[model samples]
Target chain A: MQGGWHRYKEGVMTGVALVAVGGVLQAVVGRIDWSRAAFPVNLLLLVLFLAGLGGMHTFRSKVGLFDRLGRLPASVSALGWVMGVTVLMGCIRQTPSHLLSDGVEVWPDFSRMLSSWSFVLLYVWMTVVLGLVILRRIYPFRWSKIPFLLHHVGLFVVMVTATLGSSDRKCLRMTLVLGELGRFAWSETDRRSVELPWTVELKEFVLDEYPPVLVLMDKETGKALPAEAPLRWVLEAGVEQGGFTDWDLKIVRSIPEAVPVAEEGRLDFVASRSVGAVYAVCLEAVHRKTKVRKEGWVSGGSFMFLGELLELDEHVCVAMMDREPRRFASRVVLNGGNGVRKEGVMEVNRPLEQDGWGMYLLGYDNAKGRWSDGCVVGLVYDPWQPYIYAGILFMMAGAVCLFVMAQSGKWKEETV
Target chain B: MSWDYFVYFAVVALAAWGAGALWAWRGRQVGWVYVFTLSGLAVFLGFILSLWVSLERPPMRTMGETRLWYSFFLPLGGLITYVRWKYKWILSFSFVLSLMFICINLLHPEMHSKTLMPALQSPWFAPHVIVYMFAYAMLGVAAVMAVCLLWLKKGNPGEREMTLCDNLVYVGLAFMTLGMLFGAVWAKEAWGHYWSWDPKETWAVATWFGYLIYVHYRLEVHSDCRKSLIILLVSFALLQMCWYGINYLPSARETSVHTYNLN
Candidate 1:
């Protein structure tokens, strides 16, 4: 068992099989996510990744492949890889068109997610068994080292906590204001309702503000074209040192149009003034004679043209404008997460409770008048807050223990 | 404390980085050189970040806080690596990364700051974001180590470093996995769902899987493990793409709660 292949077949393989059995049992009856087709889809792709590498034969044939290919020579290489990867994912995340096309609507609230039996199953299996199996195979059941023993014990703690404390819970979406506390209605009529213990009210809520973030792009990369600057709205305006004087640069806004957010708020408006880069666009113009042309920055309406907006994805447009700045009806923005009773009173974060339910502050709709003002809040009534907290604590402890052990192996080597 | 002065900070950082790079070219005691250069550079950038935070009215609600994140990750990531390895050359990398983040942040400074909306005033938020960022810095290093170990293993056909490298990869994966799980738990507290199919969430899953691949790769160390290393590198890269990419895609953006309108 020099490389431990024999031990793996006898001990680790069977252990893995036992873990798989647990997964299978749970997949059938434990949780919804694992049972569903999506879980298999995830696994299948993973399997394919392994298959592409020629399976165990290839893995076992090479020694120290990890040391060579797992990392770059220096930290800069690592950062470069990370940056390259970040940009790649960013492109995927910010698709020019929706990956799932054809006006695919969200499944109305989080039902598709929370109530997903398939996801629950897969999540449970992954959390409890796969992670443990991997750990056990690596560290085994031996209580030889302190770090090793702690790790083994820690994994057990995480499992107990996730399971006993708060594995099953649900929430609802609500719209409310400060003084006018309301009730939470469940999305599915069949689902059981949870009621809050107190008559709560949202006193006030505020969006933590930040400064205009600077963005840089390579001149050659399509990320930022000096030759073809987009019609950029002022997402923000700030004064910073430039050369000798503090140069005031206005950040162009770029808000991707998302529906769940829009639907939650009956009324919505782009931050016309400049909260952040809510929207931006890149355009190409033909020069008078040369192929090159002058590209200047302007909002969609910053210039006069029926220019098409650059839709970052099918759903949201990082373009000229979402909807031209319109006068909101309410002076007090009633966000889904905020509650307001009038100009004098405000509510947010705190729920406005009434009846047998609580109305949480989810978000607010930009408005110009009384009728237009709107807000949305996520509502939940967990009878297991304390249990959940306990479980979280256990999970954190287990995780922290696991982390410390992994980092302190060198220390262990010295001690041994 | 002006943001403009910080631009100079970036220049200084780059100079330090370049100097360190030059030192590396000369094959001298570069780790301390790298550390001193980056430490000074990051502190300068951090000072600017403090100034930005103290602004009477910050204009940083959008992805516009690019420079701020730069200041944040560079010094932060640099400090973390310095603490872990204390290697001089490694410190040089920190300076380089911090400068990169700063440069990127400066590029989009015009569009980020926004007025405080009603929802963002919660005390839990800053801590959440700050912890998450630091964790990311730590995990980022781990991911890098994983890649480096794998690559080195590949270069040395039957070197003794392979097992140790595998161990390092495992270590990184463990930390990152924990961080991902922690983030999910935090989400449950802040929002309701412990898991959302937001782009960030999905990509996080992918990243975790990448870690799993490394684990499996460890088991098969006596075999062709280059593929596994490639997977780790690829997966880590995907993590970056996911963070920046999902913002542009409208469907993912429309459904996701994590972005806070980053796109």
Candidate 2:
């Protein structure tokens, strides 16, 4: 029992010593420049790391520490340390590297935990422990160990590939304007414009917006009425009705596309699909307490007009809020530099893959809404994603085994 | 279909669950307990189905919508646990916890809308969210079991009860793993990256690690009942942060894409 306690204490000291070395290295060398380890460098490092791990496992009988580190105490300590660092990572606000150049004041090391040498070293230590665990189980393995192997090896693959392959992953953005051929894209990492192999021209942009909503606004503060838990009624042309806070409201008429018109000293809206058209609604509101009625045409307005509201009283009025976009897509014609042409629609959550690149719709001009003629597309090329998916599959299989084992009471109970 | 009729469905489901709990506590007519519990599930599921149809999409977008799933799963978990372990008190505990969520929903209803954003219109949305809700329900049951086995039972829990709690955690972790993987795959398909280390993702990993430590400690190290039970409660607290505590964190509020537009 004394020997066992001493070994556990030694294992914890080793873990703490590793952390100290990491902190010292972090202070000396600054953050790890991952881009410096791209491609062959990462591959070489991985090979060396594995070779060392295998050598350690083979010499476990010779080195007392190797056998000790392979035991549960060391593994648990490593996991506990990882958990501690991860908790710290969650608490700190980690900024993306590209955004670091924006001149915002942030903690030097913690702000970029992913790139900090201490964080990287801690993960490397974890991988080493995990590698030893996997090696221990691999020798003289039975079918019963398959689930354990899957879980550990799967995690190992994900950690190794995601870390090393991150440097090779490329994310860039391209903008396509209607009727204009575009080939240049802005790389997110290095912040430079690069010409693409293919050109894309936006043929049409479609934006489907949800119907505008009406909120009772305080005429003085110009904010939603009732201050807390403000009520909103979605306008659906003569179909929906609701009451809120002493006011019964109804949509008398609605127009999806309309422009303001003035004729015979009366301001009204005419339905049109012309430029700068806005969503206009006719509302009738009744004050339940006072038995007073108010009616008028109101609009959330567009780039061309300031919105109009119906005065319910001196204190409050019925105001229209801007229509929220439900979905937006850009129809584009892609021309490969080699004379191949293809047409596709790119939308959020729907990426068009072509020539080893995924093109995802990122943004449109919020000011122009549906009338915007251009859209930003994010292009990404990640070769390591397939390996990551394989790892995910292995972990999923192991998880299934765990579930089944737990449910059937087949787990081998350790004697207490 | 809408929250307007939620009170009726809530009351009916509560009555069925309450009756099932009473029947379970009496330790008589197991068939009647199953009947009552299943009827409650069916009625609640029917309401969800109607809401899904009326909304023209899965009702998994808002905080209130997720609560609807939580309430449904709590009793469902209770029934499954009772079926597996024959725990008479499980139903009463789940029903009371589930009732609290139902009451909250009834009092503070959100605006009902049929508009689903473009980013949410993925095939992965429903399964990802539903699986997570189920996982949360299972873990919640484990936490309640921990509380009972620790405090209420005066830390003298039977081995069978302890094993049952462990098994619940196993099931919960299994589903949580799947849910996180699904989210990662969907994120890769939707966005450019699989994992962005966003605040929500960070908290989720912390939560996963917390439970992992408990599982390892219980399985390999000493199975001190008190220590394991305490670990369970701590892990549950981490899960709470991953669930809704991120919304209130200033660091998370601006950065997390997982934040639901609650209003």
Candidate 3:
């Protein structure tokens, strides 16, 4: 009895230490905003503190209620219930179209439902039951307990962190115009405008396009043929198109930007270094049956057709230009109210993080290519990110431990 | 390599898988079964490698591209299970499932463009997808084993069968956990949020929780084989939804960043 008492005291101390560590981590991670009374952090601390103390054998031995609640059947049933409800919610959220058609706002409605009193009660009840079951099962930890502890504890930590951090999480869309400071963002939940703590000035916006390709099309049917040529093909002195059509077309020259010039009473093409320019291809075509040769410049947004009758030939031969935007990015300078300044490049999949805020390049003005007016960025402020990351790390470590323990062949010798 | 070459290799690989299944059924020398199956896997891997080399990127960008890896891993997983448990019918079931995916690829060939979108050109893209596909393969095998257990005489599965099923679930769950963690980490880097609650993500978490419940149920209840089998089957269906069924969700089509423009 004396030895059991000593062990119980040690467990209690350990539990207290664990909860204390969690509280300190929360404070350090900014999860506990003291300015707001840190209610969420305090609530989490209280819950963990109670859980830690209850995990002690001394406390557990004094309370018959925990033992009764720790019944395996009850825990399993509670888990099933939670999983069922969560899945149902998830299924409903998966059909956004249905929700929209039903006049239900997806995220807000889902969030409201999750935070509703009934849902909260259910969530808390199941969490408590599950936690008790895990605590009871893991009290006398052995090698075999590693997998169970990792999986369950990791899950509990993640869910708790997510819940505690939800109210502090904020997402907004910010549009930055070139050469102008942007200090306002539209809330993602609602389109209401909100002022940000920092000003973002777009230094420049760049759009990169893939190499242009020339496509052959049947003007009559308006159907594209399979024949395609790269921009390099324009540089070639001549090229044959017999495989694509009955006409044989030869490229005379190509220019990135072409402007027409009248030389000797005939039209000629010359390269122009203009801000807004179109790709131009000068070609010579020979009719297969008539053996007549013709030459002209076919610029992007300009049409050229070849045939016996001008109108009839217009339906027989056509050329189309195509190019896809490969990537877009924004160079921006962020000026914070705290007098901190930073410069960063924001691109898709590469976000700019500064002073607890992340700015992601969502898109750019499609009509203006390299000279776009500005870019659209999504700004996110999540105080719970550190906790979430910690939870992920813990979960990953737990998973690895379980996997390694299983492979070490020691688990088979220990009976659950 | 071109789609034509892919088709040729796929046909040959499927033929080999069929022959291996025949040998397994006949109770022929295990060496011949190993030879046929391993050769099939080799050919399949070669096809993937060729496509990767030709495309100048990992063949994990498109739905059909990822399906190629799934087709390969499913049989590989079944072969491993068969070798471990000496289960005769495992390879045949794996072959049929693999054939279905291969046929899907043949019927609806997607654009095999050489260019990968900037978002897909990340270091995490390959491992995140590869691990998920491997986990799916393991779970697929587990589901097959559960079905076999369910069909046993009087629905009474022997201890050996139960152990096999449990072991499969354990390994599959570990892989699933790893895959999910990798994906979350990748998403944090690319999308600025670790958990967006996207439709695919929601389904994935639901599937994970479903399996979690199954594990707890098996441990706590000491349930009968039929009940366990049902749980596994249901978990497998959730896995399917997480994998591709989410694509059919209209909300996902509009809002999910993960959707693949297969057309």
Candidate 4:
């Protein structure tokens, strides 16, 4: 009974009991509806939880369970349960409940682990155990314990606030057509149109793309030729290339923006920077084996036109693929309607902030591609982000301490 | 400056590391080992620097680019371990793994695209990936030590070797924690959520928890070296799944945004 293994057995048994209780509760009552615990309820619950922890600490000597819960055995058992649950989550496919189609239920508990009752219960148990461990260490107040304190406290803050504050988070998509003042947004949660505080007008949607490349594509399979490692030749103006699997190719002329025009007998492309213009390239390909040569025009066409390819033979053809976007930005002006106007550019990963909301460039009309006249922006308001950041900062300091201790060989000395 | 010059740099780095491994194996002076290993690192660094300059962007957007960093950091981690614990055989272990990566790159060079998508063009991109790669290398060295202790050590290894193993895991876990946190912060700035339980993120957290269990297990039973070594190996396997195996998993292939576009 005095051995550490005995303590681990007791701790693990306690964990199993908690999980069983959670499962029974889940079966009795369906998934937890988080929206019910929105702002004031969540705040009240947080205060009560802290007070309960303090009471547990104050009465530790009166109860043997409290003391044991603060020990390493309990900590390890709690972490093991958490790890097991997380691993199960990784193995099973997860989808947000809202995204699933109507009346489709597949492995309900394992599929949506985040919203399941068992996961919430397990996390609550871990939080309580971790809080007790921190309290036990803080009372002694050794300078060396700062790192441990930081790591535990940081993790506690992140877990508590992120879960509690999730119900209060609001995310919506705002669409702005060209030169039009838009004031409505589609809520991601309910898919309903909601009025916004400000009106947005899109000034311009600029898209910069990489130069299109020509590839030898198989006529039958439609995959790039050679199948394994297809060779791509960049179509640049006045550029020439050869050594493409017994074929020599040269770019005779290239136009960034062009439109096809029928003149007399043959169709020719002339440069025109219009909204629906596509990239057109004129190239000459010579077959090395037979000395046969072919020349024509090819274009990675737009929504209104089909892409043109130069057939080398019945087996393969030289074609231009659609250019990949290098960068896309939406320049917009926002008006709050009372002498408050803001102008900025929003791009992916570079969100614009205003009035405690972050606006990110989400999508554009894919069918129109670069000629899209409207863009969709995602708006998010997360009040608890600051608290999460504070936790991350503390963890960063703890990590530095961990690195220094390991590098200086202090950990080995202390552990041994 | 381009991938065309990768073969030359790989050859030079392999030769220098090979000489260092030989010198260490022959039980020669420790100072010479540092000279040859560092010479190899410097040569590899030169190629990466030139490529970064020529591409006008960081060379960390593709699978092949990540391999370059892995090869560079493996030997550097080995040197750090040797300096701290005076374990000379660590060089041989790290160099062999490094050589394997270099050979893979030589056999099949990935397409080197100069363009990066809008979502990947963030300031956090470089540090998040670089830190993760470094952490992987450190954990890999610890895994190698675990294998040696489990199989090769005659019987009942002494406390010194176990201490070395523990030290490596501690450092590796620290770096891993930093890398995950950095990724979370980046995700928030880019996508508006700190964590969405994406398949890749789920696997990553599972790996972190796997290592945490090992650390606690070691603390609980210092006498049971066999169980602890097995735990370390299992944690390493989870790390591999987190790193690249997620790309192949059917559950992750459709929903995961972290998959590398091979095109």
Q: Point to the candidate with the largest lDDT.
A: 2
Q: Residue A297 in model 1: shift from native, Å?
A: 25
Q: Show pairs that collide, candidate 3.
A: A220-A315
* Every model's TM-score: 0.56, 0.94, 0.79, 0.95
Measured by TM-score, the strongest candidate is 4
lDDT of 3 at B13: 96
* Models sorted by TM-score, best on top: 4, 2, 3, 1
User: How much does each candidate deviate from the true structure in C-alpha RMSD?
Assistant: 13.4, 2.5, 8.7, 2.1
Ranking by lDDT: 2, 4, 3, 1
Interface RMSD of each: 10.0, 2.8, 6.9, 2.3
Model 4 over residues B149-191: C-alpha lDDT tens digits? Answer: 9999789757788778777888889889999998898888887
DockQ scores for all the models shown?
0.20, 0.55, 0.36, 0.59
Model 3, which residues run further than 4 Å from truth? A1-65, A68-71, A93-121, A190-194, A213-322, A336-340, A402-416, B152-155
Tens-digit per-residue lDDT, B1-263, candidate 2: 77788899989999999999999999999999999999999999999999999888899998889999999999999999999989999999999999999999988877777778788899999989998899899999999999998888864888898888889998898888888888998888888788999988888888887787777667654556777788889889989988888888766778888866645
Candidate 2 regions with alpha-carbon error over 4 angstroms: A1-11, A101-108, A221-229, A237-245, A264-266, A412-416
Residue-level lDDT for A114 in candidate 3? 52
Better of 1 and 2 by TM-score: 2
**Lowest-scoring 10 consecutive residues by lDDT in candidate 2 chain A?**
A100-109
Per-structure clash totals for the candidates: 144, 0, 1, 0
What local lDDT score does residue B72 receive in model 1, on the 0 to 100 scale?
A: 54
Error of 3 at B52 (Å): 1.5
